[model samples]
Target: MPYTTSPVLPPGTLRRSPQPVLATGDGLVLRPWRIEDAPAVHAAFQDPLMHQWHLMASGSEAEAVGWVERWLTEWEGERIAQWTVADAHSGQLLGRVALRDIVLADGLAKIGYWTTAAARGRGVAVRATATLTRWAFDAIGFHRLELLHAGANEASCRVATKAGFALEGVKRSAFHHPDGWHDMHLHARVHGE
Candidate 1:
């Protein structure tokens, strides 16, 4: 499909332009990334499983902090919107969910997420993905949402299916994994008009 431009936000916003903290099910909360969360984010990124599955970059504590800082700047500048997934009760960081390539005019966006190994298989990704999809369609007025996963990642594919995204077919060599280019399964959900 088509990628749309980012949304434009009003002035003087320190947090995400359209700041929203969403709670998914009972255990997970989706909110904007915070600078203080760098340590937890750094530790999560160090996990080889996360690096392999999510294709995340390796970084130090300082680098993690910088990454969050840059994300904040991008959010404020209306470049990308990101959310940090955390435990609702214990307030522990779980992972992250983001609506990237957001184009307000087209009312479309893409969903991407990953949870820490400790939080896997607990429906964290599914719940968070569903929550974000709902928020995007309802609150943000998005008309469509898309998710893509490496063909080898069955768990990610399951999350998309569970969240009501229809399998849109596979794209050959759609993603450049660390090993090489891999085919990706594309999934999508359109808001009820």
Candidate 2:
């Protein structure tokens, strides 16, 4: 069955312009990633808390550089809008946030984030996620944004809730970890809701 609806955001919406830098209003900013951030990225991956959930190992700065390069291209491709969450004045890296798996026609994307150990207890994830959510809805015209995290990730759940994402339900065995499959909590926020 062919259902008809206009593309929610339209083509070239993201590709037409350079990615933007956004402020969290609490001394944090979300900006585009750069190659110079490789050292910080490598350090973030080495943190036990970050490694536990993301399971990505940036053993060398070179690998982190590749990740940054891919993120840069992903913006031009309109697939993902990744940002570096940083201190506004010092420009120190605090965390990372992104709208991944963006679908222009559907106007939907998945929210993802993680914070460095020093930024964890200070609500960096929540602010960055909320800041990105606002931009995705108001600036880019995304109709809906979803945030999914392992059911065991209480910190992420708190971030989602604080960012105004309502818990929709769980996806059983939705994601794979090194140990086994795990249930994922699905949270979402729709434009105007």
Checking candidate 2 for backbone clashes, the offending pairs are none
What would the TM-scores of all predictions be? 0.88, 0.97
Clashes within 3 Å, all models in order: 0, 0
How high is the lDDT of residue 180 in model 2? 83
| Deviation in Å, model 2, residue 143 alpha carbon | 0.5
Residue-pair clashes, model 2: 0
Residue 5, model 1: Cα distance from true site in angstroms: 16
**Local distance difference test scores for all models:** 0.82, 0.92
Worst lDDT run of 10 residues, candidate 1, spans 7-16
